[model samples]
Target: MYSAEIILEQRTRALSEINLNGFGQRHQGKVRDFYSLPGNRRLLVTTDRQSAFDRILGQIPFKGQVLNQLSQFWFEQSSDILPNHMLSVPDPNVMLAREAQMFPVEIVVRGYMTGVTDTSIWTMYQKGSRQMYGYNFKDGMYKNQPLATPIITPTTHAELGGHDKPLSRTEIIESGLVAEEIYTQIEEKALALFARGQELCGKGGLILVDTKYEFGLIDGQVAITDEVHTPDSSRFWIASTYESRLGQGQEPENFDKELLRLWMRSKGFGGDGAPPALDEDIIARLSQRYIGCYERITGREFESDLTQPVAERIKANLEGLAL
Candidate 1:
């Protein structure tokens, strides 16, 4: 792992998106650029482009590599629990995966009542909403409070320009988004995965607050799709400070993109109007936070390959692939 100073100095390239037109049919999502390959496969490249509340914020250096590698780590760790769409990671920011019949709902599992997004349980609860996504909460609950048990809150998988709306299990099934049996299977799998994540992250001195998982059908079997346990897909807080912070009515130290969101919120931007230009200092700090989370969650050092440009490195690494 590089030192903080070294990591900042080496964060030279930030990938916002990839334009691999000739490679295959390209589909650019919010953060991932998909290049469809022959034989039901695709090259999924995670970019550094950050988004919050359906708004695209500026890119963060080394963020893509951290998210990709971290998700790869979690996918490997959780492979025994469920099959995933990942075939292999061709590059640090790329995953060669099977093209799946994806579910239309994103499965979100929460162990606590906290978050700043409108779809967040805490946000809804504060707005005088006692019931959310079929889960009813008692009147008295504080922010960042742990729940009696984890709850599954699914949301519609909206397009890039749209917001993801929360949905109940019944709503999902009634709306034909997912069948009841498949939804039950994924819900159990998601909870088990969350337990495994919490166990692993606890050993690493971090709290796996909550996370969203996407699933898809691969060969008629439900498989974990997209990223898992990444800072972009989950919320993490410093374990040691959680108790004291909550006792003091302070938000715990979060390592996810919530920091970026907080910064944007302070500047009076939340998925509206034009986003303020991110300065070099903000980008550097965000990169450091992402690296820190990666190291904490995986218990490994993050080594950057700064010798070549990101695009060149990915292209060279993927030369042997079928894409």
Candidate 2:
């Protein structure tokens, strides 16, 4: 459990450049570092790096723990839906997982027609395009309105921070990115997972607005890889205010990283180019938002060892682990 002042007072930092000497070949990602290991396993280290629109904003202290722990929680909660790559949690910020061959697409399920990114349905619709990601929308749709039904709007899985292109069901099937049977299986799993997420979030007074899931083929079976529902991979809105806010044509109260995105955009960076350095104050607030979501979702306090350096703490916790 940490307060904003506690976060700001912590001297230890875990940046994106951290390296584990004994770990195998490392593939650095935007917010995570993947280390390949023997027996088709991998060490996934979640860093405190904050990202938006496929661009790194800054590092939020302990944000990695929030993301890693949240993913573990969701994966276990939804394990009945499909298998996952998670092997164990060696540290709060690390996941030792099966090195499943991740698919080239990201399974994004949206319950509402909203998002500010270029690939978001709302953005595309606002630009006068009624057709997007294999979903047809009528002209009367308002921003943040719920869709007729939840839909799978998949996107190209851009490794690291590259742009993610939208993919329709037809394009995905016809292009042979994945066999129809396999893709459809994952699709059903994703939808079921989303429904499960909504059911769980409802009890917590949050709406599972939309979330992205990554599935990979492991042991000849489709298993979810990377993560499930987390602040970085999903959108969460306050459920009680959603209806009133929608009726008033106002944005619903949310605790996702879109706050950081809006702050970045206000600074004249619309994710088209490089962004200016983020202030420490905003970074602290962002860390609080992640913590808030974790607490609300799991109904548990987020515990972190602020007295130790994040990278050093990870190294110590992972000392005896077989990667």
| Model 1 stretches astray by more than 4 angstroms | 1-12
TM-score between model 1 and native: 0.95
Name the lDDT of candidate 1: 0.86
Candidate 1 lDDT over 72-149, as tens digits, reads 999899999999888899899999889999998899999999987889999999999998999889998999999999
Q: Please, what are the lDDT tens digits per residue for candidate 2 over residues 104-155?
A: 8999999998988789999999999988898778988889988888999999
TM-score of each: 0.95, 0.95
State the weakest 10-residue window (summed lDDT) of model 2: 9-18
Query: Cα RMSD for candidate 1?
Result: 1.7
